[model samples]
Target: MAPVSAPDAALRFVHPDLDRGPEAGLVVAGDGRLALATGMLAIRQSILMLLSTTPGERVRRPDYGCDLHRLVFAPNDETTHGLAMHYVEQAVATWEPRVQVIHIDAHRDPHAEHVMQTELHYRVRRTGIEDSASFGFDLSGGGG
Candidate 1:
């Protein structure tokens, strides 16, 4: 009998619940087939979608997203970044029950006058694995 490789061994022990199934919604694949995000990728994409959506944008779910858009025209300062961080933290915690937020950091982009960078650090609640996501909030009339 052939021995199992290390990678295969690791796959054998993957917790089933860590990747239960595809998340909500569907996307068109490269070949036009419907696809869905799964596991951590799904979580990350959901985070981005939640951040991009503004409060009251969704007709049925009025409170589905972060309030990042409200600061689009605000001054690019610590206060703005602070509010952004707060909004992100609140949204992820409230909407995404799969992960526990570790930290949220926001700051003005050093080279871009109208862009602020926000990074979210979180640990998957079920797996305890940590990951981070970064987003550029574009101001100056450009969408985030």
Candidate 2:
């Protein structure tokens, strides 16, 4: 008799993957509300770091770039996104008119989108001011 395969045996799944070139233009909606997919925590961190700058501090980059900006976490959980937005809003408030948010992720972060929108709305309402700016939020991924 042949041996039976384990019910939960680990298997490697592979497909004929195609090598796509580099990405093109990337844009981040300044409306404020944003939500990322799962497996994108690193990207969220990077955005926070970028927005949060002290009086004088040098920006440093690690050897390899980090990739984490998804929003497929546990059901109805927005902790990470909330923290990120809080930091972003604080930075924006401190550096208003000179802060440009750039979000690079592998998917459209719904949490991030929503957060950004909410912050921007609040800022507009409180300050009664507006300005045009350029930001980047690169989303790259293969829809499963």
On lDDT, the leading prediction is: 1
Mind giving the per-residue lDDT tens digits that candidate 2 earns over 1-144? Answer: 254343212222111121123432222335542322211222222333334333335545331221223422322235544543454455555543333433311222465542222222221322344322222232223322
Worst 10 residues of 1 by lDDT: 10-19
C-alpha local distance difference test of each model: 0.77, 0.32
lDDT of 1 at 117: 85
Candidate 1 structure quality by residue, lDDT tens digits, 26-49: 445676755444667666767777
Q: What TM-score goes with each of the models?
A: 0.77, 0.26
Supply the TM-score for candidate 1. 0.77
Candidate 2: minimum summed lDDT over ten consecutive residues — where?
10-19
Superposed Cα deviation of residue 48, candidate 2 (Å):
12
